[model samples]
Target: MKLKELAHSRTGDKGNISNVSLIVYHLEDYERLRQAVTAERVKNHFKDIVKGEVIRYELPKMGAMNFVMQEALGGGVTRSLSLDRHGKSLSSYLLEMEISLES
Candidate 1:
């Protein structure tokens, strides 16, 4: 499945490092997301494309998650070429991700 299909919210540029925030509407879904998308797994998924580190942040208060991907664009901001046309596509991508709630 595509990364977008697994994320509740996602955002980033093509050539520059970016961060993708995800919000699991249901607690059950959050558990599934947590198990399905791991830092190592995510890194591996984008290993060929990204060149930096992939970090994950958990927010229990908001029941949300955040991913900070460094150098994923192949280069730093100075040399990266990735661009977000509307700056909102990332959220849409995240919403496309599908996961089952933990039982």
Candidate 2:
């Protein structure tokens, strides 16, 4: 199933960096989400877009995770020639991640 089945996402951008958050709809799925979604996976998912590194921060109590992707904004809003200067499309891509519950 896609991550959208279990969670929703939000995104923010700053100076070539993109911050993405994935919040599980149910607390029970938090663990599964954590296991299936890793920083490495996120980096791979956005391989063509993100150039630097993807760092993931876990918010276990909130059933959420935040991914800090560096060099991902094509140089940020003020300078980004990309259509998604704010990185909102990145949020949608993140939610599209395929999740394996068995993992």
Candidate 3:
């Protein structure tokens, strides 16, 4: 299944970094999301756009995960020439990631 089926996402950007949060709708899905959505996988998923490291902060209590992607904004919003300088669309891209839901 795609991550979108299990979760929704939000994105924020400062300088060249973009922080994307994946929030699950159900508490029961949290553990499964944690197991499948590793930092390495997220980094690989956005490798073309993200030039630096990807750091993930677990928020089990909120049934969510925050991914901090460095060098992802092309540059800071003011300086970047990219169409989506704030990287708002990045969250949508991340949600397109595929994951297996283990029974």
Candidate 4:
């Protein structure tokens, strides 16, 4: 199943950094997402777009994970030439991550 099936995301950018918040729809899904959505996994998932480090912060009470991606906005919103200057596409891109339903 795709990550989208279990979660939704929101993104924001500051300079060259991008922050993505992934929130699980149900409490039961939180553990599964916690196991699958590691900082390394997210970095690998956006390897081509994100040129720097990926840091993840877990919010167990909210059943959410926030990913901080450095050097990810092409350069920065003001300096970037990319169409999605704010990096909105990133959240959608992250949602494409595939995971095993049985896991």
Each candidate: how many clashes?
9, 0, 0, 0
**lDDT: worst 10-residue window of model 4:** 94-103
lDDT of 3: 0.96
Model 4, span 1-103: residue lDDT tens: 8999999999999999999999999988999899988999999999989999999999999999999999999999999999998999999999999977665
TM-score of 4: 0.96
TM-score of each candidate?
0.63, 0.96, 0.97, 0.96
lDDT of each: 0.62, 0.94, 0.96, 0.94
Better of 1 and 3 by lDDT: 3
Residue-by-residue lDDT tens digits, candidate 2, 5-103: 999999987789999999999999999889999999999999999999999999999999999999998888899899988888999999998878995
Once superposed on the true structure, which residue ranges of model 2 sit more than 4 Å away at CA? Answer: none
Highest lDDT against the true fold, candidate: 3
Q: Tell me how far the alpha carbon of residue 22 in candidate 2 is from the true structure, in angstroms, after superposition.
A: 0.3
Which parts of model 3 are misplaced by more than 4 Å? none
Q: Between the candidate structures 1 and 2, which one is better when assessed by lDDT?
A: 2
